[model samples]
Target: MPVSKKLPQLFYGGDYNPEQWPEDVWLEDMRLMKQAGVNIVSVGIFSWAILQPNAENYDFGWLDRLMNLLADNGIMADLATATASPPAWLAQLHPESLPVDENGVRFSHGSRQHYCPNSKAFRHYGQGLVRRLAHRYKDHPALAMWHVNNEYGCHVSRCYCAECTVRFREWLQQRYGTVQELNARWGTNFWSQKYYAWDEIALPAKTPTFANPGQQLDYMRFMSDSLLDAYLGEYRILKQITPDVPVMTNFMGAFKPLDEFEWAKHMDVVTWDSYPEPTAGIPVAAAMQHDLMRSLRGGQPFILMEQVTSQVNWRQRNPLKRPGVMRLWSYQAIARGSDGVMFFQWRQSRAGAEKFHGAMVTHTGDENGRVYREVAQLGNELKRLQALVDTRIEAKVAILFDWHNWWALELDSKPSRDVLFLEQIGHYYKALFDAGIAVDFVQPHADLNKYRLVIAPALYLIGPGVSDNLEAYVQQGGTLLTTFFSGIVDENDRIHLGGYPAPLRKLLGLCVEEFDPMLPDQTNGLRVRGQGDLDGDYKCTLWADIIRLEGAEALASFTADFFAGSPAVTAHTFGQGKAYYVGTHAEDAFVAGMLRRILSDLGVQPPVMTPLGVEVSERRAEGRSYIFLLNHLDQPAEVQLPAAGFTDLISGRKLQGSVRLSANEVLILHKDTEHAV
Candidate 1:
């Protein structure tokens, strides 16, 4: 399902909190919103205290007024369950519901997200409020969607309270039938820590030494599912009351604590908040986040749920979104497969933890302000581009990102903590980003037949059926590019015997003899002497693998260390397909050149090749394509058009051969549109 379940038009606007203002200012806020071309606003995201002043009493008068006003003003509300924060009354009443840290200190309620996910008291009160909101707004004209809760597990991803302990025991009992089985699976025999009863089992918490790796892994799985259960508690109620309405919760991009892939399976449409630094200038990080969000739902067009109009107060140094930066980045969101453009707040808070956070209406409250003007400009452009709504970006390439591997690779007892999961994967993704290649961030189990090339980096843990899936994909003529630190362990964090990366040894056609974790400042030389476009000398970092080929032929080899001249990179043919393995991480020149060769071999061309600091992406309709050209440089840049001619949907100007974009400018060229002058 798309985010446009209720409205087919491009959804605009930001998080609206009329309760933050006086009754008199509500009308003025509405006027400002309309002036900004706002159509949709997420209401009541953090209004639990005002909605339900106490556990027993209900107060919908303010919300009722707000909903009515929005409906009257031609605005739709992404109504929240108001369960983001527990009320002060509930916290005061049930202190046990407060989350306890690993050190056994209970967090007191003053700020938001004070309750534990597994807390019975929290769910009881939270679900009760959700049911009432659903039934009340089931028929409201203003309700476009249901926002279940605001960023689940943001603050309290884990709890070490007594309540959690009991739940953990029960959860373990269900996962492993008896204590004997649990001990065997967790390898408790090693430290004379074998359990005799389920009640003896505890969460992987503070200890004199390192905790059991197996216990730590299961706890990670448990917490992710626990948070999911909490979300589904409210999600079920909303679906039961308003089955037609879509439900979503804004995801924190690439959040470490929670597994977003599993959560995405239960969502109606994916929506996430992105707060990229304006000082960074280039939107590389933001693009990866957008691709991950879109990939969560299999390339579905998602809403840009919340972004700051300018600067966010959370960072140590917050800077403004220089002039056209906001509008250019907004189009970047659209280009990467977002159907809607929105921000954290419609109106700036006069006083709160986020008062300094930028908004459409700034602290000065001037509609003519730079932020406000840019937001209105974006909204105005979005209104005319409704056709881009529900449009999808088709990519022939994908990058594998598994939270299981992410959790396992970075565990305390790893080869090198410096070999960060995101860093390794981000390195590969940056190559694709630089080449103007669209990519889907898929899990290993996802279907690979649709992709011409799949890049799997740092696959430290291989779950059941993943190797079989990869083998099948390769046998069916798919191209695979996987890296080192892969296929070493099972899902249980146990090393496979016989050889390093034993599972993938057959498919990858190679066996890793041993791997060296390089120092922070270490670099190994790589020489791809005869690998076509990759025939160059380059440096590798972070990891170096000494490989002995079984059936694979070396394409590139290490030129430094004792492992010099061994297979640093290899190519193996399986059935009708080819699998390329980089035994060690290579430099950007090598990665870019290798990707260029792989993409060129598969005939996957960029939407439009552009110079540095310029990004090109496309969204496809029935037979139409919207090519977005974004200039991220401080000076003007030009891009040669892939098509002969097209109409600039933004300025409605005819463009052909090549187009020039001013510094921090964007142009959405509509391919084969009748408006082509």
Candidate 2:
């Protein structure tokens, strides 16, 4: 219920739905929530069916009762428009609202995200329902922020219907302006794809002979825009009624179906669900997502809207999060920049697709379950650590992660098939994360000089303002790094043909003449030049861009290729700063070693207490700073505390200089002295 402009320290509680149960159950739920210190509940997420069963018939009897109960309990309701999925009656009556697939097949009801965003029937009914709900509950005392929709990627690529085609034509016109431009971008001249009029164009269909990647990429962009337009319409309508309430939509982390970065520009707040893969390197993946979400709002903290305390129901092999893993992961999000912590379902469901997903309270309604106990403990600890509210995490490292480049790289049919984008970015990210260096995952347009060291791996597509930003950053004494296939294409996916690397050639001081694409098993030798203590040779593979140094100095050279002895790694001094361009996909060891040396040179040092294999992150507020040290290892590890005396905020133990941490344990140290960057 704390709606202060300065966000409260811990965002307690989670999604609650009293409408799903009986009155007696609702009463008990409230009792348990208060005991657990639950302060907020995201209500009415999927209540569209109950709210509007029929077009002309609306019911708020149950919702009114639910709100009154929350108000009595002093719980803030994160009210939702319930417009993610419309009622079955709407789709049954107006079939056009149901989306058609790329294969020219229209979908049936029964699943969420079934409505076509471009369908007028769907837009009218959806916005009308939202308008009604906003007017009805705008003045409710229990209302917190507005959650516009649930996770937005349940529906795949949509809208090949007639209405969609018309809108798609309009979008294309706005983008390309003329058929000649469209033809050139899509390479229409190669296969007699010359379009005389806008009407002649069609979406990328899943036909046996007509699967064009460029066209499909554009279709993805269009679909994302279409959904964003729908979301914006609902948001504006709600804002018209409740202007002060923040509006957000739950986003699926690392979802490839939609461009969430573009969608984030219009939202009042950025929020996302975190469900990491159970693989060996999930921490890196999770960190990448957390940083990406923060970058969407220009480094502002986002809401960790949903994560399971234990096993989930959807994965084929559901594995429980090991002891202490949940706490560590939650702190990982907070250490990055998360303002709130929540889960999908407060209480486990008895029937539905997510019946088995872990919840705060199980179906048995027991308060002593393992998950419930963990939630209870976290709730208590959050109550004590109230100083972290609205605090910021500072970083000197910047890793440029662009959705446009990701999209473009995947669509590249000519590059080596093994050159996956996320995997490459993740390799660098893991190196930095393991080194305990705070990294900002950014888009091309982010502020450059805020970071001392900038790492841009696989920057395949450069946008309008990126080159200038990098140029400025380098001129202002910032270290810039980029890899192969960079500066090859502009925002429109058109080739920048003044040489291989367009505008960055001057900054990099290298001209790429030819590139060698190799299979996964193929290997190349990278020999270090200009002998030093770290001078040696290494193995590398995948696509290698052969370069000739114009003004830069070569650090490494190819050993056995036709272009042997050519510069594989070059460093160029722009003004007060420098740029390193790695023209090949180098080995992880070499990359880590090179980055370590570069970071050392740039004075990008982690805290003196930073340890290997452990995560060290710091967040600073007005009067104090919290240093989070987490042991992600399976075995116990010892840690060196800050030189100055400090206290463990989580454990209430005072310490002087050093400490030992158990496996998967986390320590939040409160430093008395302030260090502002």
Candidate 3:
């Protein structure tokens, strides 16, 4: 089977913390769960304290009873390995499990993610506990998937411990092969900071700070890799006991702590916790995360591991998801190729830090609440149409999101503060979205031939073979877009000098002479070089790279500055394809307007071109394509879809090409079965 019932269609439920509440509550919780239509529960996430209360003693009585109850209740348990936050006893006994911050101070373990990733004691015990747990319930009828860890890198930027320092040296050796090469790449000779031996190096301290961004960036990579190793350690044990089961770790959305691309290599299926802010452009932000998760598996459907049933407790303000927001977001995930939709919690906790966090059954323990009603309705709808839940969405555009580049660029204090990486990438993504284009957010090393247009915004760190892969894409006539502050650094956060935009200068057809960072109010105008529909003056700022155009033509020029009339945007026609470089940040209009022309020049068209605040996506499987039309507006509006003959999957009504939708309404049209995957 291409899919598994272990992760059933439209996964209907979320986290269950039997460890927090008493055993008497389990039956009632299960009763409330069935009433609220929760079919799956993620158990054992934070049960380390209960499962193994002491070093010598292991208690499985509570968890075993909980799993048995779930089996009897017809509920599937998304069994977590119970290794996110180590028990207090272990941390107290083995002090090495506690993480040390960048300031070289040991942190107290009150919250989760405080364990040292490189600690041998933590790995041995953590994996041992998981092995025992998996073996105990490996063949349980209710066990679905093995969830490895909970939110792998919630505190992404920590860890300056002795173990990390030692491991960092080894990671450097493997990456650069020798100390001399490492020293040269890091420019250690500049400050007379060259290391004669590997053991001499220390973790970069933050308080009495040193301006060594390259070292800091490399250390971040080392830390993320270390955590990945920790996850794999437990994962290996689980697979050893139960080889047929799929394993996963929940990722934070667009989280920069660890390279998710690298982490995805070891996962059986990619899963994530999705909680976009209410103020955020819902579809755009959620789409980016969903595409990111999907891209990890190269367009394979991923699991929506955790979303809040009502609201979250962590943010400054926990607001209830508006009436249709939940359903719309759920379908949006499906529309973006998600095979499962689960929440952070099943039942509300009466006590704990997460008590206030929204749950299906509130503190009242009644199903009369508004949140419960919404959950029930959504669950019923999903149950009615389970066949559509495992569908897929494929696209013609791919944007490369490299955590390596993201870490290196942010740590490099040299770049302008205005060059915020995710924000810049969001600009291009928003442009493509506004133009109604379907995009696959991908890793740096994804198959280039799958996408007609591949955008790599601020690819600061040039990883192994990425340049060659990109060059091959351009050679094969695919449109490539890269920006300034890109191609300047290597994988180790070391500068690639000789010329600016190092490895990709030839491919981009522009040699960047110098770049000047600007403030928020700073302005640079772009004058039209050659006349087209976009011949008017446009605004650009934040940073301007004076371009030495080799084979590329200046499409737009800065109207004012020392380098006035210099190229702000350039395009190189290489072989049968082209590469465009945006030298500085431009307005959204400029980006959208420019990209439309470029995508048009390449014959790429949006499935259904519509106005802003509306999202159109198509999910296809089993010889049927379901076009999801969402109107994120207060007022009703009409959209002219591509086809006249189709039935709305939501309303079960036939629709013409010109169709109408109400405010916050979703119209899923079963259109063009021939093109379905």
The regions of model 3 sitting more than 4 angstroms off are 1-3, 207-211, 281-283, 529-531, 672-677
Instruction: Candidate 1: list runs displaced more than 4 Å.
Output: 673-677
Candidate lDDT (C-alpha), each: 0.88, 0.81, 0.81
lDDT of 2: 0.81
Each model's TM-score? 0.98, 0.95, 0.95
Residue 89 displacement in candidate 2 (angstroms):
0.9
lDDT winner between candidates 1 and 3: 1
Query: Considering only N, C-alpha and C atoms within 3 Å, which residue pairs clash in candidate 1?
Result: none
Deviating ranges (above 4 Å) for candidate 2 = 1-7, 208-214, 278-282, 529-533, 673-677
Q: How far is candidate 2 from the true structure (C-alpha RMSD, Å)?
A: 2.4
CA RMSD of each candidate after superposition: 1.5, 2.4, 2.2
Return the top candidate by TM-score.
1
Predicted structure 3, TM vs. truth: 0.95
Instruction: Evaluate residue 457 in candidate 1 and report its C-alpha lDDT on the 0 to 100 scale.
Output: 92
TM-score of 1: 0.98
